[model samples]
Target chain A: MKKILVAAFMVLLGASWANAAGTAAGTQIQNSLTLDYEVGGINQTDINADDGNGFLVDNKNDVLVTTADVASVKVTPGSTAQVLTFTVKNEGNKVQDFILSVSDAGAAFSLTDNFNATSQSIFVESGTTPGYQSGEDTETYIDELAADGEKTVYVVASIPASQVNGDASIITLTAQVATGGTASSQGSATVNDTGADAEDTEQIVWADSAGETDAVEDGKHSDASAYEVQSASLTVTKGSCVIWDPANEGTNPKRIPGAVVRYTIQVANAAGAQDATSVVATDVLPGTVTYGVGGSGLTQIARVVTEVCSCTSPGTANTGNVSESTGTVTATYESPISASETQCAYFDVTIN
Target chain B: MKKGFLSILLIFAFSSIVYADVSIKSQSLQEKIINKQTKWVKATKVIPGTKIRYINTMSNNGTVMAQNLVITNAIPKHMLYVDKSAKCDGVCSITYSVDGKAFDVPAKLFVTENGKKRVAKALEYKAIRWIVQTLDANQSSSVQFDATLE
Candidate 1:
């Protein structure tokens, strides 16, 4: 049967020439020759020859990017969007089209990029779900990208409610090398096929390699990626002391006129910050003092107390999460105070 | 039909007088560096790893001696041959082929892989030959090789 259909069409033409990355940009490469000779006893007829137009195959363009983040992304200063991931890769031989852009100006890893990240877009990773997908990645640039293809890019910024705790920003992303067969637009940039050699036109050979800010062969590349920030820093404080004074009935104690006063307020939170939730702590009784006298409503003390309302082991005092009404004085703490934690909130008054 | 159109015009006038006794040419170059010296030129376009070369020549125009000759070539299909580069000038003999229909000699080719047997590679050749053994009558020779483009 036609040699088993020509050996199954040469195994489907060697599997589409092993998937491609090199021989495709206009591919002509005809080269012929054949000859044969004879004469003494006679037998002449086989010449062939070539060089009749056959050259093409050019375009090596290249593109790389990389930075699918392996660290520094822990952001949270008001956070929104905030992605980073990068990948690009089309180390070209043909099918291209890239053009994406983003830049926090550069440099940042052990951090020092101080702040600047608000609405910084650039998407293109709609692989149907594989990271950055604010509702299915919106596709901002790299369209065709084949030959050794790669694509997974994103940047999506917005972390700025005044940015704190280690601040940082970085970003970068780049990509450039365009012109591959229009399909949604952008295609144009690709430039570096200068003079001579036009054996049938197929030019463009930049070969990319510099990245981090792009340069060598300049078809653009870049990488970087940072962010940092991590919120929650709290601190408060507030001391007060004159514990009991029936006219110095405990030695040096005197705020006079029925003395008794005691109040503390600490709070803390800050050993690398983040984790200060719920904490309340209020206190407004000063019409010459009188809200509960020697402890009555708020006494949760024991955060390693530093002496002001004195409480070495005095934790339980009708702790209904503490509260007093018109003369104020409230304390809440529904848990979270972590990170180098401190939390005091004491209360005791009677002076007028 | 006019005696079959006069035997197709005498077999196209006896194969145009036996194809005027042997000739051939072919070229395709590439090397290029220019002002810093390197120059080879002529290949109008080629990038995926470039190399090229090819050459060919062949002559011998009439009055006798042209024996055995041969030549061939093929290769081009995203290219790749280069190992030992293939040359040919005075005495001739060269050979190779993978499957552009059997040629031989690099200790008789081989190729099978996975099913074992190996030995082919010069990027799996595909065709080259050469032969010669005589040309005389005004003579000419050439034959070159190279390849790479993949």
Candidate 2:
């Protein structure tokens, strides 16, 4: 009879050790003690008593937010769609929803925060695809995020045209704990359970530590990321060299009457994320000089100019439009002068 | 054989006349922030990961001393026993059980994992037993163990 009872107790012990996030709230941990003793060398009956009602497990609410980008996302000025990614993880012991928001007031990256991005929008990454997709990841706020579950969130914005190269816009993503259970909808923000502890019901407690902008136990967390402007910087310079003359042709040509001079206008852009487009260079010839002896008097080209104002390489000819009217030469280079590229406009004139 | 059985029944009845009465009672406690200080109070607001202390008091209420007093307690469900937290106020030997059927010292408890037998962790302990040599009349002793809610 005693062996059967002992075996039953062993079975109960094995069932209670199942792994979980924690014991569910309001679970009664009933326990009793069994005492066996012998008096005067005689075995006595066992004694047992009921321990006081066991305590209930309270609610633990915690969350973590971290920026997924190692560095600020590079964007060009006037970029329509730029993204900064973050991760929101539910560190609590139960399911929860998170209300998400983005703010321009945040910690800056290595670059100075000088501008604010426009049309800022938040998105929750869909599990179907990774990273930010314009039309794919459309969910704004997190819903029904399970314990230890994390979702990638994107802060999408547009870079204004006025924002120049090296300008940065910092964006902060904040997630506030909210009531969970419903799907496809935003839940109300959760307040920590307060007042006297109730043994029958699970009480909510804030267990999260501090994040970038949130205090400890505040049921919310925040992290910051940035978008830095990486626009093209273009510079233009014009130089002229004597080409031919009646007396000293192509050799130490003088700035005298009938001396022909070749003019070169160079437009160079530094290596950057954007390209300069619709580049037009114009030079007004003096009354002492006339348009080139050749037809049209203008030829648009491109070259790698190493020394300042020095043009030597016969670069590939550009498909730009060139026109000369009343001794003034205008050349519109091919559209979109790419980064780390130099384009030059060449025209010749004769001293009259 | 009938006469021998009758004599044994009489001896059992005589021993019952000089019996020792033993009683057991249990209590559960949890830590709470009361006023400005943290104190161990009756578990009122319990939650996951809360550390609970289960205490069992054993007392001898009769005129004779209770010999070989053994107190056994099952670690509560949904809880993990804390290592080295079992204690007894009197001179006693304490052992643990993983399955509640086989009790052994902490060093002797073993569990099989991946076809290999390894020493059981404190969290795997399911039951605790404490044996005291004797409990004198009108004397009470308590045994306690701490566990954290899973």
For residue A207, give model 2's deviation from the true position in Å. Answer: 0.9
Kindly list the per-residue Cα lDDT of model 2 for residues B4-71, writing each as its tens digit: 99999999988776757688888888987779898887776665677888888887877789888777
A1-352: candidate 1 lDDT, tens digit per residue? 0010000001111212323567767666777667766677465667777777657777788888888788878888888898888898887777788999997777757678988889999988888888987888998998888888888898888898888887889888899889988777778998897776666787888878898887889888888889898777888877777666776655687888776666767667789877877778777777887766543233323232322234323354322265679998787654677777766666667777
User: Model 2: per-residue lDDT, tens digit, A68-97?
Assistant: 999999998788879899999987767789
Task: Give lDDT: candidate 1, residue B126.
Answer: 78
Give residue B30's lDDT in candidate 2 (0 to 100): 90
What level of docking quality does candidate 1 show? acceptable
The candidates score, on chain A by TM-score, as follows 0.41, 0.78
Give the runs in model 1 whose Cα sits over 4 Å from its true position: A1-34, A39-59, A72-100, A103-172, A178-188, A191-228, A233-352, B1-71, B74-78, B81-127, B130-148
User: Candidate 2, clashing residue pairs?
Assistant: A22-B150, A23-B150, A56-B46, A57-B47, A58-B46, A58-B47
Q: Report how far off residue A226 is in candidate 2 (Å).
A: 1.6
The prediction achieving the highest lDDT against the true structure is: 2
